[model samples]
Target: MGEAGFESRFVAASDGLKLHVRVYGQPRAGRLPLVCLAGLSRNAADFDVVARDISATRQVIAPDYRGRGLSDWDPDWQRYALPVELQDVLTVTAALGIERAVFLGTSRGGLLTMAMAAVRPTMLAGAILNDIGPVVEATGLVRIKDYLGKLPAPETMEAAVALLKTIGAGKFPGLAEADWRRQAEGMWTMRDGRLAAAFDPALAKTLEQVDLDAPLPTLWPQFDALAGVPVMVIRGEHSDILSAETVAAMAARRADLDVLDVPGQGHAPLLADARSIGRIAAFADRCDAA
Candidate 1:
């Protein structure tokens, strides 16, 4: 457990791999837990700011999915599939004694949120889909694949930040140097005095199975299952992955869905900013009251 108020704990997956989860704040009776799920190749650190900000109101749980952060890596990379990841989530929730939670899922994590809704709708009090939807644009996916695991480890933190800037230049326009440094730190770790990506390289292999030439699979059914639950969706204004058209369709289907399109961002917005965090907190409070 971390001494910084938050508790760092591990739960064993069915296959015996240990998955790490950081618990923030004390549990309040009748208040729904908030779980922040990171994007592909990202981990619990991605939620540091938002989790800390909202922990005062309700318990916050951030998990380092298998092969990311302190979690045990799967020898079989294929196990990185969504079904296995979903089970891992279930195991963590069960171990934590949480019957229901309001989930904040980013990118790939958002897809997992939809999957969970389909398989276990009762487990979700609400969900915030950050920069993701039923349909994924091939262009964004192709862009991600272009460098997913191809970048070499940086020799210094400065180099890591530079690399990130070069790669993420126009995507997150107006992000300050400090924000980029924070992002670099979150995505990579210093090991042997060099910076390396925080996730297993095999994680990128999962993307190889995607057929960019063909249409990507839609998760409308999984999304439809969330109709009973309060839901919020956040989109990066310039995101290539979650298009405006898809968000419109989602809103058309669920009139109650709350939507936020963050300006000057792309693919995914790092929910660390004040405005985004405040909006999410408000949505969560509403869910808790409902």
Candidate 2:
């Protein structure tokens, strides 16, 4: 077993939603917890590879946001918006008596981290923005919107594995057959021998409101709040979401902020690989020390 024993629990969010939180690591280490936030549509298990690789000195809590993963689907699809997600994050921490934590946020999770900076700056000890930045490109976002809630049912787990291989070919290449199966297992929920989206299909409505054609909003001010704290930004080399110019500007503004660009990936880089895991472990140790 890892230093922090793996366990699952249902934590009550402010809105009475019992969000599922999967924990890894030692909570009594006297260090601020390290919270893993998944992408918009993904869940706690998205951090399975991440949680195992991080240091055992601090706690790691990964939660399935409102309408996704093991969490109960919201009857009102509008409740699946960012505000509710952000509130749920705060509520989860409060329930666990965690006053502060290092935020490792991916994609939509990164937005929540920034939003927290805007609303509750003191709650974060540090933050690592995984393949995301304040200035998100519309083209990439549009592509995400296209895939949300579109997963079709697969007749068998083998068929699901095949479908996962075909769909993730461009984003995830050089993956072994076993790794592909693992990805599929973590992504879909099987019921009655059929595969379904792990999340509620209605949550798709919340995504339709995203206006991709408009100019990206300025988010440096929200990000600047973490200037004094340790900040690391991971970017995929081929990503359309975060531009090179914006990253350069961020580095110029904050000397402590580190920027790492992963090659041969686009949109987002999966942190499951050994190289990516090592980087995260080092960053977490640095954050623990800070």
Candidate 3:
């Protein structure tokens, strides 16, 4: 639950598609703003709790990438690639008049953060990557592909919660029943009195094209571009996407990198928990002090 009365706004992407942003809290002078980027198929709502908590000290902004949440869906699904999404993020930063920010990126968002560091290093004050790294595990990619865009429409809220729990059982072990319900609310939208997934079904096409048998592209160079900027990497102990080996490599590359391992979570740890939120807040404080 982010602060009440957050401003809902939009900016146009290079393709003329409208992208949505949720701005929370007030901007404090001399403090770097926080920009949150969600995972693929996720929206600004995913950071509701985190925004509320951090905004008390500095401004927090979360944007729904094109084709997800309130943003305009691309008619050509191929535009959903990383380069295009990275440009869209740049457009958002420009539209908001943000000169610099501490990026809090999760999953695909974390990949975008690395891309930004490579292309627009000066714009980033720091970054915290949640459950993602230069190397992605094939097992995790397979799991995501299994149900990416193929989720069935739920007849009721109860059904939606059940579906999420069924698919997310081992992934989010300690999450309460209420958290699952909240996740359902964020992931699906009620249209014409029926619940359908909030994101465009075409999003799955991007994953479908990936050949798991072949090696996936490595982003280590992009990560290396962030050498001077402060960085924090968080990993869920059971995360299939961000393996322990990748985390070690990331740490090896950046001697000053802050690392945290959240126990009992899988692909990603929800930042709503006190421990995660506190860690982020402390990391931001250090970035600001520097």
Question: Worst 10-residue stretch by lDDT in candidate 1?
Answer: 1-10
Expressed as tens digits, the lDDT of each residue in 234-285 for candidate 3 is 9998999999999999999998989999988888788888999999999999
> How do all models score by TM-score?
0.97, 0.92, 0.97
| Better by lDDT, candidate 2 or 1 | 1
TM-score of 2: 0.92
CA lDDT for candidate 3: 0.91
* Backbone clash count for every predicted candidate, in the order shown: 0, 1, 0
Q: Which 10-residue span in candidate 3 carries the lowest summed lDDT?
A: 1-10
Better of 2 and 3 by lDDT: 3
Quality of model 1 by C-alpha lDDT = 0.91
lDDT of 2 by residue, 95-122 (tens): 8888888998988898898888878888
Residue 126 accuracy (lDDT) in model 2: 81
Instruction: Write down the lDDT of every candidate, Cα atoms only.
Output: 0.91, 0.80, 0.91
The C-alpha stretches of model 2 lying farther than 4 A from their native spots are 1-5
Itemize residue pairs with steric clashes in candidate 2: 4-25
In model 1, the Cα lDDT at residue 261 comes to 87
